[model samples]
Target: MTDNRVYLFDTTLRDGQQTRGVDFTPADKIAIARALDEIGIDYVEGGWPGANPTDDRFFSEPPALKRAKLVAFGMTRRPGRSAENDPGLAGVLGSKAGAACLVGKTWDFHVDVALEIDRDENVQMIRDSMKLAAKRGFEPMFDCEHFFDGYKANPDYALSCVKAAYESGARWVVLCDTNGGALPHEVSEIVAEVVKVVPGDHVGIHTHNDTENAVANTLAAVRAGARQVQGTINGLGERCGNANIVTLTAILGLKMGYETGVGDKGMKQLKKLSRMLDDRLNRAPNPHAAFVGDAAFAHKGGLHVSAVQKDPKTYEHIDPELVGNQRYILVSDQAGRSNILARFTEIGVEIDPKHPKIQRLVEDVKEKEFLGYSYDTAEASFELLARRTVENVPDYFSIERFRVMDERRFNARGQMVIESEATATVEVAGQRLHEVAVGNGPVNALDLAIRKALSTAYPSIDGVKLMDYKVRILPPPPNSDGTDAVTRVMIESAGPDGTMWRTVGVSANIIDASIMALSDSLTYCLLKSGTEAKVDA
Candidate 1:
């Protein structure tokens, strides 16, 4: 490792699994380990081996990493146990990882209350654990758990714990803000003091996000001479989370000019890696997350959009492409013609600012948005609207009529069940086809019925699948509907080849909005597949 290179230690599989609803299987751990290696992370902490079967199985057959060192995490030996005989220590050795991280209580309060052990014994624990790990042929690292709070309470004891680990041959002694209560300035000052004894090159920083300052604190530690940063993907951990490595990587590598293993090329994979974790967990990505979020570089206001179009540095801090994210211009009621043109240009639709169709499309978008359509999250819908206005796409089929009904009844197993059925009549190739299908919900039934009606004529329709659906209720539009609310539906669809697209619809009736979006999703898939124009033209 270069002297200026800050090592990235990913604890997503170990600390991140402490997240309440997160439970990564053995395979999930292996897959994530490989992704981290591919991204060139210096250290990948697999998990605590002896604690659970999943982690045990993972260590038993860890993936063959190309670049990253697979590190196993565990605690130091218990109060009275010898390090050589401790099961936890043995498990770490048995893991066969090239490196091992042992977390020990650095806080006097924790040593007195949590472990009920003498302070001297705790120091011995840290010393013995590091010595044994090194003797076992693993690169030993010690995590000074609660180091900041411990330093504040008893600076001498915390410093002694760190010294013990270093004197015992620890390759790295990580200062952990276990409670995540340290402010940036405090972290800088504390780390500065700690490094006086253990050298900055041997220091690392691990922080939680309870106060939402984990990222800030990590950077402060780095500025104070820490060389290694420990965090998780998307900040996954217990409670608020650990520091977000994705955000930290960008700031350290791009902003601070620090060298990380994830150089320019690996930085481009940051967004994809973040999204992959969310996808595997079936969780939605935070649109506003720094660096990798959907709206990280999105501009909305007219003035901001105009300035960004000229010079992105006016608003954006860094080039979004550096982190594999793109700039987005949102068209809303606040949009000027500049917003419209910028949005069109982004979607590859060339429209002059003064074109008559530009004003028409902008007006239509504003009017529809007033009726509860959000173009920002539904760019695919806006693109279809623009395409229809500039050069009308061929109508593959037209809906003659449709109906959906829900019936609650007892199944043959005598269990109560609610079934939804939909029937649709569509015109295709001058022939009318009527189809009916039952589904779990009204929208699903409608989707099934429409696809059944068109699949025989356009076999390509069979390849489309509705991947996700979201519904948001908005206040009734002004003066048009007297009802209590209107519904906006966003549908995410996937093609057979794994291409995904999103479409949006709005109406006073939930089913109506769902059907509109669902139909648009199918139509968009067909258009992209180049099969819409081939259907009995």
Candidate 2:
């Protein structure tokens, strides 16, 4: 039997930076590189060493990768320049990376038109760069930019470019779909032909999502015997994007049954890895992304929920848990008993399926949804509501009343500044406590006041921090004015152990909605931490 092993190379630090809105600082590069290494990526391409200040700083003190080889990216020696003197080639060779991937043009059109150089000179540039990298004690890889289109136009020249790299000690010869217009069939056919000259183990695939076929094209190459895959996390890149390595990781492990550096343990962190990238970029995650998306395993229809309850395979292609994603039974006016029961199991709530109160819980959720509360994105709030309805949920702390005051004033330095202060009256355990605090904003002030009121009683609150806050205004009820419209607030909090949960609130007043969500966030954190509540008689 064939070993069927494939190498996973990540370029999120390099190619991903080309994304229009993405600009990775040195610190961002370090953190992302470490994350890629932790997830068992075979190679982490840091960036071009001397291209920009950020890239220079990143390579100056590259993150120590435990498993993956740190790769430096640059171009081959420019036309008419010696491999030793080309500043671009020197940049890559000077880096402390274990490996180097130097991109060179393979398309004859690019050689004649773009570089305005002889075809033979272009091939020699690739060969000399690879040989120098090998002599310098670095594993060399050649990125044959526009190889797919080059092959279609001039197969012999394209093959010669990669063959020169392989013969000159390149460990990997990557064929790039620079135009990203090639179909899956074209990629498969071209890759199969290229493997005839260079061994499959030495062949790699890099694709763009111009036609939305980047992932498909990559898979085609793999089927055609390419052994290395290069891509960015979440498909971040110039133009449309690169192939999404997150989706590829899942498909390669669970569906294709190929061996990769990422083991079963690393496979389980796929969703976390995907979301971590989005969080670092301060962008919302794509809920409909394949395999690891939030909506990937969510079942909304009653019939689908009922069928999935009997056996998940009825609708799901693979177990969501395989990729660290759980099945979400979304309940609304369209929900059934199956949805409620599945949700209970998901939250670890042990409730009888036939409990008389289950119907009431469903009705209550529907009412809340109609009143502008969306549980789909706020499962922590839904879980709390479910528990409070049928279970004896303790009142850990109650906010009797709260007030926030905001003012603009001049500081001692004569600089104008805005300040907010909040006061909270709360009852916890057996005592009544009143706390006041100041913060940068009204919500921040309220949060500080609440923490002050609960810190002595529950020190665990200190370990939890609000990660995100979002608000949405719903349409006014009936003939009510737009000013009287209800607002929904959702807060995402991360605990000490890195567990994140989201809670939601809704009210006509934004402050009231924020307080409700904030309180639920604290309550959920305490419950998950298993802190005992003290209530005096």
Candidate 3:
């Protein structure tokens, strides 16, 4: 608990909500805000009060506010109207937040271009907004819009804008490189220079990633004396995307020794949170993220695994365990016995260096890998392989034969409809069950048959549901018309507990892909339920 507190302000609900294709409902805003608060963020900028009904309602609603200060963000009063009557400015005073942030045009170009007003009038607009905020007893943060580019184009006008806000009693003056194209070196020097010419108590950096340098520029700003940093969750913002808090928190906490969301969870949650957001948005997580990404702690080279086994510090910067991450000793064409043994040891299974079983398993894993089977993404497949030599695995259900029908017209139908039929069997405690089911597609048919056949044995499985499935085609080199194409499938399952895991399957036949991925999903569920799973196929 270092008292050296740098406040965290997220505009995800405000600016982030404005990202194209993003529309966080009042409920969505509340949920994300609570999560951010629980993670130790200082402020959650909800939204502009008068701008939309959802935001205005968010400000008025009594949602839980645990650790974050709720802030209403908006612009200043209009030029011709009184601050009290200007609905936009008045909404700032009317919102649920005790504090409000007012952004005003600071660039001479914006004045003449976006606003079609003169520099003096733009300065007056900022002055009036700040004064109204102060008179209304609100903590005012002045966002000097495009301040960096403004200063570059016309330093005098930008400086004049800063003076207007200060003279009118702004609490914090944030420099916005709104275009997000500024480099780290430029931001560092610019902020240091800005500090010299203005009061520096609450100067903040609000940057985007048009140049993919928002995180770097923020770190440089912090090193150069900017007191506050602002960005978004998963960096969801307008244009090329705003600064990603995932990268921001990591670099700041790990590289710069700053305190952020808790350390242990912070490191682990980086990957989890990234994937969590991606899952909600139906997007794939980047395997290349730093610290907690899938590839972050992955080992491939045999020498590297051997060295890391002795001391991971030889290749890794820090123990990934601190962040809830685990080291992976991969088994691929690149593996040596050491890599295989290292991986086995992590899972509580140790093998002799020269054991016959060890060599066989390693070669088998590598052979399948060369054929496009990646255990890294196919945890269930690996589990199956591991169990083959381990112990007996229960078969809750096994597919016998399945059939699907789709036609523009059918004998039994006046109109056209696709039909599916599947048959499966299961043996539980010496009693066997054979069942048939129908669904819309091959995967759906299998899901139906398995559920029907296994219902008596695994009664709790009625709660399981397949949430998503992703498929890719890998055709053999000499294939024609996709005859020899390998269809890879990844299935996501969720249950009553809200837990999720992805299972992968690959085969030349589409039915095989579905069945394999489904089998993996069931095996994972069984293992998770404290039932020992032995995968036979």
Candidate 4:
């Protein structure tokens, strides 16, 4: 049984793709629209069909709109043009949209300057577009452009514009903040009066983030009985952006007790959706973005971690599962053993609270952080440290001798010479295989040197690869001297079996940090593989 009910309208393909440096092909639009339907959006605004060939293609692609109704967004009909003959309206019909939304000039200023039409003609266009769309067998959404400002200027005229949408057979009359400059107080007041005459069920809020109050204003409107909230994920769009669906859905479901998602898939999908979109757009996700952000559930500081240990609600407002997010307690200079234990335990590795190894782990982390190595944003690194501290016999094959010669001399063509050699000897059952490989980097040269030399003798060792590497010099405190810095490295790698994990390394020497992370990344992958194999068998 569900208690809360509020409609979710996603405009990611239509408006979110309008973000600068962002463009989605028809296939991309189809993928996102299907994802929206999977996530249970009440409406998926595909795009302005008549406006773009990509949107036109999306309609013809036979999309699997599982749970969401498809909508086409466009401007109202031209003032003098017949609505049926308008290219915009024909696009809506051709696209086969179950619903169509037409935004018309509502403010007197837009009527005069933007639409380049008289007030009377603008109203006529609104009526023609909606009535035409509805008569053509589509649910119509009327967007009263700048309707809030229009109301303040001429209350009677603004109401008349809304009345036009109603009489035009619009199923949902959406009040659009085209310029995104309306205040919450104004939105609530205007929406309150409009709802009195507009039939609350047929009203929706279409807002933008220009004033950075999209989230706040959306809350105000929902409080004022607006049924549908229009938004995009991550608040992405042209200029400022539209309201964020992630934020809106979270607030409505968790804070306002409204039913936004239908199942337990909500919380996990939220984080995944945010990351998937980030990957698709090739944009680094905003860590501070609410609900699905990386830091939304990330915990640092000994104090926050301590309280979270007792009651997560002390620092976390909503259960992370509510948004498909999970708590990540990261260990840093500010961390205590509790933080380490919490993180390790969550990942299924437990360290004894009274273990003598904890002292070494604490000292190692502090020394690295004191130099400039932070494990906060680098949890993959910290896990290696935790594993090393507790595991007595880690199968870590130490590096022997390595050298890098950048023969970049002004006198002659530069020759890069990197040679490293390493050894890894493992005992399985009753047999022992000792292998060695050499590679290019002081570390890589050493790793390959050991593996290359060893693989000839050991048939069990087959697959290997190094995938990703990241390095950052830890920042000094406000009053601390900046003379010295330690580089923290994070490396992600994968072996032949398709296993992948990140490892962290901290060293005063940048090369050593890189080596540490690489070595740990390999070991973590191997160790997890070994553990899983044993369990499966």
- Residues 148-241 of candidate 2: C-alpha lDDT, one tens digit per residue: 9999999999999999999999999999999899999999999999999999999999999999999999999999999999999999999999
Better structure of 1 and 4 per lDDT: 1
Q: What shift in Å separates residue 289 of candidate 1 from its native position after superposition?
A: 1.1
Q: Write the per-residue lDDT of candidate 1 for residues 483-535, one digit (tens) a residue.
A: 76888999988888988788898887898898889778877776767774534
Local accuracy by lDDT, each model: 0.90, 0.92, 0.76, 0.76
User: Model 3: per-residue lDDT, tens digit, 1-537?
Assistant: 343445567888888877888877787788777767766667778998888889877888937787777888999777777777888888888777867888888888888988886668778888888888888888888898898999899888888888778778887788898999899999998888887766555678889989998888887877777766788878889998777776776677676777665455546565666666665555666667667677888888889998999999999987776555678777667777787788667656655667787777778888877676767656556666765655445554555555554434455657667767776665443456676777877688778888876665666778888988888888674645657668888888887799776677788877788888887788667766766333332
Q: How many residue pairs clash in each candidate?
A: 0, 0, 1, 18
Give candidate 3's whole-model lDDT: 0.76
**Which segments of candidate 2 are over 4 A away from where they belong?**
1-3, 25-31, 57-67, 279-284, 429-434, 456-459, 478-481, 529-537
Q: Model 1, which residues run further than 4 Å from truth?
A: 1-3, 477-484, 532-537
Which candidate number would show the highest TM-score if scored against the true structure?
Answer: 1
TM-score leaderboard ranking: 1, 2, 3, 4
Q: What is the C-alpha RMSD of each candidate to the true structure, in Å?
A: 1.6, 2.9, 3.6, 5.1
Misplaced by over 4 Å in model 4 are 1-4, 403-468, 474-484, 493-500, 507-509, 531-537
Per-prediction TM-score: 0.97, 0.90, 0.89, 0.85
lDDT per residue, candidate 4, 1-537, as tens digits?
A: 232467888999988988999999887778777877887778999888767778778887648687789998888888788987887778777777798888887788777887777889888888888878888888899988888888888888888999889987998888888789999998998889998888767788988999999988988887887888899978888899999987887788767778775455754577777777887787768988898876888988878898999999999998987788788897777778778778878768766788887767878888877766667766656776677678742543444433443222243356654455555443332335465655554566545644553344333344656665677787656776885556777776666776556677777677667766765655565565553212110
The lDDT of model 1 is 0.90
